[model samples]
Each structure stands twice: as C-alpha cells, then as structure tokens.
Target: MWRNTMNDITLPRASNHLKADALDIGLTEFIEEFGDQLLESLNRSNPPVYAGIDNPARQWVLEGLKRQPFPAQAQVVQAIAALLLDQNEQAGIINAEMGTGKTMMAIALAAVMHGAGYRRTMVIAPPHLVYKWRREILETIPDARVWVLNGPDTLVKLLKLRDQLGDTYDGRQEFFILGRVRMRMGFHWRLAFWQRRAGGGRSLAACPDCGRLLQDQEGNLITAEEFQREERRRRCDHCNAALWTLMRPGKSDGGSRRNTVLKSMCRIPTIGPVRAERLLSDFGEDFLASMLLDNVSEFINLMDAKGNFIFSDRQAKRMERAMANIEFGFGEGGYQPTEFIKRYLPDGCFDLLVVDEGHEYKNSGSAQGQAMGVLAAKARKTVLLTGTLMGGYADDLFYLLFRILTRRMIEDGYQPNARGSMAPAAISFMRDHGVLKDIYTERDGSSHKTAKGKKLSVRTVKAPGFGPKGIHRFVLPFTVFLKLKDIGGNVLPGGVH
Candidate 1:
C-alpha cells in the first residue's frame, strides 16, 4: 500500500515553497496563494515617509475655497495627495475648470505637506491668484508660517538667508508663495538688482561665478566643488545661502545685530527703512523679538486689522508695480511671465510639480508652455490635471505629452521646430511622436461629397486628438466628459461631493 501511494504522489515542492503546495504548481497560482500575502506584508508599514507638496492642483482648489467648506469630491483630493507623496514625479497640472476649486485644492495639498512636517513650500501663482493664496493659506492651515515673498525688502530677505546660514525659518520649509509675475521677471530683477540691496541696507556677496548673482548657481557654480560647499555651509550677512563657520556670531550681540532685525522686519508690510527704524526706536531693540514669540493667531490679528498699522498706499503701490512687473511681461498688458520665475526655483527643488491648468500649456511655443517644460526638467515625476487635454489643433498635445513621459515621447520621435511656438513645425513634431495616435482623411478626386453618396471618399473615424496631417483625436485615455445634467442624475440637491 505504501509503495502504491508513493507511485501516485507528485514530486516534492521546491525548497522555497511551503509544505501545502504539493500539487501541480504554476507561477500565477504561486502568486495567488502566498506571493501576494508576502508582498502585501512588505508594504504594510509606514516607511519613513516624506509628503512632497507637488499637488498644486488640489492645493490650489483648497486655497480657492478656504472660506467655504471642503469639497466633498474625494477623488480630486486623493489624486492630488497621491501626487504629493509620489517622489518619482516631477510636476502636476490641476485642470479642474474654474470655480471647481483649484486654489483650494492647492491649499489642501500644501497643508497636508505642512502637517507632514515638510516646511518651505514655494507656490508660483498668477497675479489674480496671489491674494487668494495668502488668504487661503491663512484660513486653511492656520499653523503654517507663510509669507508672500514681496516688497522692496524682498531682495534683502533673500540675502539675509545666507547670513542666517540656515538659522532662519525661510531657510527651512517655510511656505514661500509668489505670484507668477513675481516669479518670472520680478524674480530675475530681484536677483539681478534687488539682491544687492536685500541685506536690510547691506549687500550680498557677489556670485562666485559670473558675478551675476542673477544667473543662478547652475552652470558656472556647479563646476567649483569647494566654493559651492562653502556657499551652502557658510551664512553671509545677507542672502539665503549657507555661511562659513568662522562668521557665526556670539549671542549677546545677536539682539542688536542689524541683519537680524532686518531679517524679521522684511516680512512686515510698510516696515521699510524709515518706518522700521521708528518701530525699533519706539519699541526698543526687542520690538520684533517680542512679536516673533507671540501666538500666530494674535500676530495675524495685529498686522492689518489693528488700525494703528496698515501698509501705506505708496508702499503697497510700489509692491503692486514690482509684483506686476514680474507677473505681466515688462510692459503693461503682457501675459504672465512664467519662464522668468523658472530661474528662481528652477525645476530640481520640488520632487513633484502640479500644473493647475495643464490645457493652458498645450501650445508648443507659448510662454506658459515653455515655462511648464522648464519645470518638467526639474521635477522627477509629473502629473497634469486637465479637462481639456487637447486644443482644437493636434499640435497642442505636443508639449503636454512630452512633459509627461519623455522617454516614450522621445522614442516615438517628437522634436520642436524653431520657427516660433505655435508654428506648423510644432504641429509636425506632434505627428512624428506617438502623441498623435490615429488619423481620418477625406479623399476627393475632383470634389468632395457627403453621406448622400453624391461622391465621397471623405469620412470620419475614431482617432487620437493630434494626427500626422493636422487631425484631431481623443483628449484622454478614458475621458470623463461631464455635464450638469448627467451629474444631477446621481447627486442630491445639496450633495457636497
């Protein structure tokens, strides 16, 4: 009986297998039974997590709706939060339609990262969006130390960062939000000219490279290893860079330090040279020091609501102009200058980037599109949020698609032509890349005809949004084309979600 049983038995399982798997086995079966459990166990723990606030789309939405309640839309916030945690990503574009709460979404995302202990978040927004960002941040994430980087003292703040040598809040993850205009051109001006005067009446060290502190420490600075290290390690009397150990000062003199007071005073509106001196003189040296230690809520209440200190119209107007100069092009009616801001933050700083309205960047040569590309270069993983993924033209997808998956887009062959941003060459490049999937052509020997059969070689077929010969195609893999009526079918009268 034993010999017979042995003959009927299958071979013993592999050494790696469990005793229960004596029957016939396959890879799929193995995975189903035990492999999945093993893998799940591996991911069950909260591995030292870092929540990167790249979900600007969600964050923006949250910011926009701060006065209102949180959107009941779970998918929107979830998609954005995931983007924030995804370090493999570069940039994100939240394409929710206007009034769908894009600003609030961005604020939510920023709050999440801040709650997760990530400080120093920089938001680059449109001019119209600046006050919105400030208010939303204040309203939603109350504890987040935020400062809209502005004013004549803005440059001084930048230089003072170097002096503090990382001892200051700005050195860490302080929420540093700027209007897009301020970011692009305003930033360049700030670095080029403003940085010199950033040190609260002091000057920052000249760039170790081209002497253009404006150039950013990209090409020339990267080559000099020691200087870069020292730059990071040493804090100067001005700027946000690190300073040399030799320069750190003792404590007693810290209170009277002109740079320290300047650092604290810059964030205060209307507190420039003259006003700053008066405040210091009247309140004594400990004026700002006392304010700094106050509770955030009280501190905010004291800023504008208190009648004694409102920013002067002159000061506010000057700041408005400066910020406008950055947002709009140099002239009056210019569009938001995104590219200029790219110089300040560059791409590498944020692990993921969220573009709020990705459709706005579908054009290959538009200043906004180019700016998005620059951001893409800096980010590791990118997610674009857009309801209108395609422009009426095929070329619109060229820039947007390239930014998402560069390897696949490049392998498929999409290269930009230099005639200008919206040129036919740009359209052609979209065709070369797999970005344009399908095409429908109308053939006409002598003339064209309709389905009436007068004579027709022309027809329409389902194809990709952008095709080789200036054709149209699908916007998304599975477009969730939404409308009010369709939504009303499932939603209650006051359904928040």
Candidate 2:
C-alpha cells in the first residue's frame, strides 16, 4: 500500500492522425452555425469574457469600456458584476497572464460588488499583497471604506469592541484587508455568558427536595424531559444549594457594561477614546454602525432577546474555543463561514464570491481549497478568476469544477470522506478517468490484471503538435524530423525565428 502510494506510473502514448482541410471547414461551419452558443458559454463560463451586466455601476463600468483604448479592466468589472447581478450558476476564472493587471480587475470587481450592496467581502491573499490590496481600493474606489485586519493586535481591538458594544449600534462600512490565514480563521465566541445575562436562559426555581439545578417541571438537574417527569422542581438528592440561579441567554450585555464605550474606543490601536470618537466622526455614525456589525456579530445574537433560540451554551463555547485557535495566523481547523457571516454580514450578505488565483484550490485536499469550498457553498453566486486553469491536464480542472458545482461531485459518485482522507472524490475519480498523466504503478504478481484476471496497461495521450498550417495539428505516423544549426556558429550569426 505504501509503495502504491508513492510510485510513479508511466503510460503508453497513442499515435494520432490529422485531416487539415476537413478540420478547417468543420471549424468554419461550426463558428458560422453555433458561434453564438459558443460565445454565450464562454461569456458565461470563461475569464476575460463578459458574463452579463445588470447593476447600474456595472453598466457604467461596461459603458466605460467603449471609451478606453483597451478597456480590459472595465470589461472584467462589468462581467463580474453581471455574474453577481444575475446570480448565475457558473463561476468565473480569469486566466490573464501574470503582469496583465489582475489586481486592477479584482479591485474593479470589488467596487462593483460594493455598489451592488454586498455587506462583507473577504479577500484571501498572500501577506505582501495585503497593503497592495488596500492601495488598489483607495485608488479605484475613492468613496469606499477599507480596514486592514492584521495581527494579534487587530484581534484585540475587535475583541474589545465586542466586549463593549455587545454586537450592535456601531457604524462601519469599511473594507477589511487580512492575510489569507487571518481570513480563514474568521470568528467564534462562547455562548455561556450570554445565557447567564439573557433572560431566555434556564430559569431559577425552588426545589422542594434537596436543592440542585432543575427545570420548571422539576426532576433531576438534567434535561427538560427529566424535569417534566418529577413532581417537585429542582434540588439534587445529593446537594442542598438553591436549585437554579436563572442562567440567562448565553449572551453578553455590553449595554449594562460600565466603561463599555470607553473600552470600545480605547481598544482601537493608536486611537484612544478621543481619536476613536474623531475617526468615528470623520466616517460618520453610519460607518461605525456598519463596522460594529461587521466586526462583532458573534457577540450579539446570544443576548437574551425576543424569540432567541437555545442551541446549548456548552457546545457553543467549545466551538468558540475551536474558532479562536489560530494556527500560523490563519483559522486552520476552525473556519466557520456561517457564524462569522451571521454576525458581521446582513442577511443574504454577499452577492458574489470572487475567488482569486482559483487554480490554487485545484487540489481539494488543500486548506485553501477547503476554505474556498465553504465560501462557495455560502455565497449567493461565485466567481473564480485564474489564468492557468487546465495546467496541462484535464483533472486539473476537476477539483475546482466540483467545488463550484457542489452537487455534481455527489452526482458523479464522489463519496464524502468515506476514505478518511481529504483527497476529494473528484480527484480520485479523475485518476480513475483518463485525465491525469500516469507516471508509475506497482504490482504484486508478475502482471497487472483485473479481479477477473484481465490484463491491463495504463496509457496517456501525447501532446499533439502544430503542422505547416498555422493551426494545431497532429504528427504524421510516417515523418522525418530535422533541425538546422550553424555548424560553426557563422551560418546565421544574427538569426531570428
């Protein structure tokens, strides 16, 4: 098994044939007949192509395309906006070569999302690019707000804000820039204090028997069912203390917290109450309100409020501890989009999920891939922008493809973690298929055979070549190969191809 795990299996290459004029005619006729369908699919699916345009800002951006010398950025912005506005099924992959202005395109798309009322936009990127992203936002979106969420110090500020404000009434519409690790870590919080403070938590009642924490129906200090069975409420047969103290909703109350406001203002780095107030004033009340909601929603809902649901405080605190466990500055094992999204974003929050360097997640076993999978599952729509999509193999597309079409993975017989490994079923399926190039194999007997004893040899197709004609063509079965060289480096001293 271990040998099978690491061996490189080579595959036989097949001979190929080509028919040039027929291919040309077929291509021409196909373009003439089904060109619109092809273009539509490209627009809807591929990068550097317009998907659709509906939002007004997107329209303006698209319209701006008509005026530019090249108009690539405007066109991409319009396409991304269109994809988001349409809430279409297909995600996007922008595979523009590096140094081709992907950053500008990403920023333009972000502006379009903001204009369309997207609440929170999490950008996962390398650490060096964090400042660059901020600069791009400032340059392209003059009226837009930005926040760089970096370092433990930043978390301290956010936690302080939560401790003071209780997840409400701070205006903040700022953009948050964080390292990819920080973005994955997201947020989680304990629900115990919330239960204690919120009136909806378990109620305090007297037990006629020996005192213990008991429910209203009064059985043992266990489940509500146990409480219903007992005639007299509360009191453990062993302990004699009052049965309950009325554990409120597992939520914290910053409203009653003295110095809550002071702590909120003081926690912000390099900004005391005076500076926090001044910054708040500069941005205005609405911005601060947006910020508080965005930064600290996990701290809000547990407050004993009207119609609050009880999901078990102990479980919630355990989850919070998990969320708070930071590894290498990223939220490794604790990535939870639902909780963070609920706290910070408005209902139906993100209009689009724009994934940059989408090819990075082509390996479903990767953390980036898993994290993107979560976001893709949550977002209303998703757009993956990457230039190097196929990467010389068909299975290279399978991982990212299945992630976007989440149901497709299941439909294609890809089991979920039945093997106790992160390798997605899609990857395994691709290996079963003929997409990935086989490099090695191992055998126990003298020959490789099926269970029925049928022999088998794995094979791969060799990359074809271009013929004398400018189009891609296959090598002839009978052909001669030759190369010309300056025998003494003097035949063509200043030559060029």
Worst 10 residues of 2 by lDDT: 471-480
Candidate 1's displacement at residue 183, Å, is 2.9
Cα distance off (Å), candidate 2, residue 391: 2.0
The global Cα lDDT (0 to 1) of model 2 is 0.48
Clash tally, candidates in order: 71, 43
For model 1, state the Cα shift of residue 303 in Å: 13
Give lDDT tens digits, candidate 1, residues 255-373.
54555555455545555767667656655545445443222222233343246634455665654444333321111122233433344444445444445455766665566566666
**TM-score for each of the candidates:** 0.43, 0.45
- Top candidate, metric TM-score: 2
Candidate 2 local lDDT, 346-451, one digit each (tens): 4334445656676778775766676667667666666666656556554565577777766645665666696655356645655554245554443445444644
Q: After superposition, how far is residue 202 of candidate 1 from its true place, in Å?
A: 46
Alpha carbon deviation, residue 23, candidate 2 (Å): 11
Off by over 4 Å in 1: 1-72, 83-89, 113-120, 150-173, 186-347, 380-389, 403-408, 416-425, 432-497
TM-score, cand. 1: 0.43
